[model samples]
Target: MPQRSAVSSATETERKYTAADSGSLPDLAGLPRVAGIDVDTVELSAQYYDTADLRLLQSKITLRRREGGDDAGWHVKLPGGVDTRTELHFPLDGAGASSDEPPAELMNLLLGVRRGMPVSLAALLTTSRHRHRLQGSDGTLLAEVVEDDVVAVRGSDGAEVNWREIEVEIAPSAGSHDMATLFEAIEQRLAAGGISRSFSPSKVHRVLGDLLPAAPELAEGARYLRDYLVHELHTLDLSDIAVRRNEPDAVHSMRKASRRIRSAVQTYAADFGLDEALVDELRWFGRRLSPSRDLEVQWERLAERVSEIPVDPYREATKTRIDEYFSAKSETARIEALAALDSQRYLSLLHSLDTLVDELGKTLPARRRKSELNPEKLAQSVAAVAKNVDKRVARVLKADDPHERDERMHRARKGAKRMRYAIEVIAPLHPKRTTRILARFDDFQDMLGEFQDSVVSREHLLDILSEQGHAAESSFGLGILYRLEGEIGRQQAAHLEPAWKKALRSAEKLWA
Candidate 1:
């Protein structure tokens, strides 16, 4: 078996500033609880790597092989929060030190971001650092302030640029609140010397200027939709990370993001070049991740209802068995979900979205037989969906048969998703009205979702009970829960009419 490296990481929250010289590095003794400053100096050499087009850079991810630092190793930094990035470090091994090939473990972790692209060394940078460790009276380390004098050499050209910068790196234990105050105090001390936070996103970005995509001339609608699409893509990628780590809500969030992306695609079908086949492929993942969540929901609802009645040992034992069954099934589903995200096909989806965003950002001419959709026309689509939603609403309200009502309600739910996604893409343009409509859709979708869940729970319960080897109480308890689901479902059905009527009536001429 190939040695698998355990995933190791730290939250790196730091601020950077460009300086003319490190001769004026700030003294930390003035900050709160500072006892003394311990100074350390080191010579650091590192080589940064990225894809040919710099996909990793575009995503704000950095991979580097470095030496001379106390904890020198291979580092992969992923964009996290405000001034925070998740830094993963691997020991400097033969492959990384001798050449630029990153380890397999690190490469697998980045499959979602790299999308099968080859990574090449981009820049060679050497830094002379003057590190100041701020310590409290009690000897608690507060923060590390580094003054870096950097010389960057472009890999393509032998051109070298020399500069100096200041970095304020907070101790992980210092916490965000302390970090913020300390950072600001340091900022103020530096600002007095005619220095401010650097505008450049990263040292690599400053060195490899113009290699990444430039600012684009996207139209208002295209820009709004593209921003949303990019957000969903990020959400999807984060969910992938969560899934790999076995986070509780990963599959559920990923599935919801995929559904929203599909809805947005339909709302802006004419906006830009989008792949229909790719959309279908996305749906596969949502379905794959679904069984676990669906079963979890059913298990909770059924158990809650069954627990309300008098306890029965027979039913208790049966419940344990059912729980075991669902638990095993959910685990299997989770494995499948992870597999799908790691698959070649799913990697292609990320690549496709990257391409779509790139093409949409080009100089204004539509491609793939789709025209440039006007921003104002988005309102017209809203009005059209409103009209169709009203029809679907009325059909669900009038349907008498339970089976038929569910089918119509399902269609109505889809209509609600379409309308809400349309407005969501442009909510900032007309916040007040679109915001109100989206809220109404939220309530309507929830009701429909509840009904659908009850239906699924019923089917699952019946199927489970029909299997061989059941005690009287097992049958009795499950049957009671099953009937209660039907009853509760009927109650929800009765309110569908009023819910639809109110949502549709509140938004008059949706376009207006």
Candidate 2:
């Protein structure tokens, strides 16, 4: 087998400032810590890579390979919290360094963002740097301040630009609170000398100039629905990246984003003249993600419930069975989810969404435009969805057969979900009222969800028990689990009426 590519990670916390050609780092000889300073200089050259459309730069991410630097190698930078970025470094080795393509290891982490798009050289930059290491009296490094003169050449147009900047980065040894104070002091000190923070997030962003899309802003002619669509699209992008990173709640969040967009489209379908095909595709995408997220929820719930079983051997056997089954199934489901994300269908869906957002943002003659959103009409639409949910709930209540009621309850839960999503779409227009209604609906939904989960759990337990197994103890344990789920389902069903009444009361506030 080929050896795995070596990788290391670091978090960069720094502020960048632009200055005049003659400007440079100012004096800090008598700052708060009375630290001594050490100075050094280095030269560096880096080749940045991205898709032809500069997708990475648009997302505030960067991929590069640098030579002549102490940490020379391939690097991937991801936007983090305020004034911070996470950097992953891969050593120059094997075919990765010699070849033009980025290493497979680093590329895998960006699968969500790139979505199988090809990456190529975007820009080349060289920097001449003067570095100052600030240290405490005891020789502990507090921060590193650097002054850089940078020259960049765009790979596309052979356009060259040169500038000077300063960076102040907090050292690992510095306390978080102390670093905040020190950074502010540095900022104020620089301001006194006519230096200010750069508007550009990175060198690549500045270099790309007009090549990237303009960041969306709310201004005149901006429709609320258009802004909402943009926000959901961005949320989908972040969720995609998180899913690739295998981060917690990534699959769940992505599914939620997909659902919100789909429901928003449906809620405004008549007004916007939106395409039904886009809604269908969104549903398809969410369905592809459902297996992984559903299994994840089931596993956590089962494992937690099993842990509460105080009995020995039976408890242990039940726990082991749940763990083994879920582990195998979750892995398979995750593989399928990733495969879906890599599919051409997914790319087509994204393009459709992009086109829809673009059309929504345009200004057109009234005759050409489909319609505009009116808050009163939107409230009526929301009420219609909620009324449908109420009908489903009534059907569940009227069902005499247990199996039929269970099925009807599941359908009611789905309707409730749709109603909640519709309310969320118009939430910005009436935050207080929508917030109240949503909270109540959430409680109602939770009860229904619990009942539905129990139904699924019982089915799973029955299947496992029917399978041939060695120990009577294991079979008995699964039998107990089935009984537990059955009882919980009954209890949740009993509680549904009260939850629905409470939700109904709060929902009235939407139009009141």
Best by TM-score: 2
Candidate 1, pairs of clashing residues: none
Candidate 2 residue spans exceeding 4 A from truth: 1-8, 29-36, 94-99, 135-142, 172-182, 215-222, 363-371
Per-model TM-score on C-alpha atoms = 0.87, 0.88
Tens-place lDDT digits, model 1, residues 190-238:
8887777888777888898677766676667787888888888877776
- Candidate 2, residue 347: how far the Cα is off, in Å: 1.5
Q: Which lDDT tens digits does candidate 2 get at residues 358-388?
A: 7766646334443354455677777888788
Give residue 31's error in model 2 in angstroms: 5.2
How much lDDT does each candidate structure score? 0.78, 0.82
What clash count does candidate 2 reach? 0
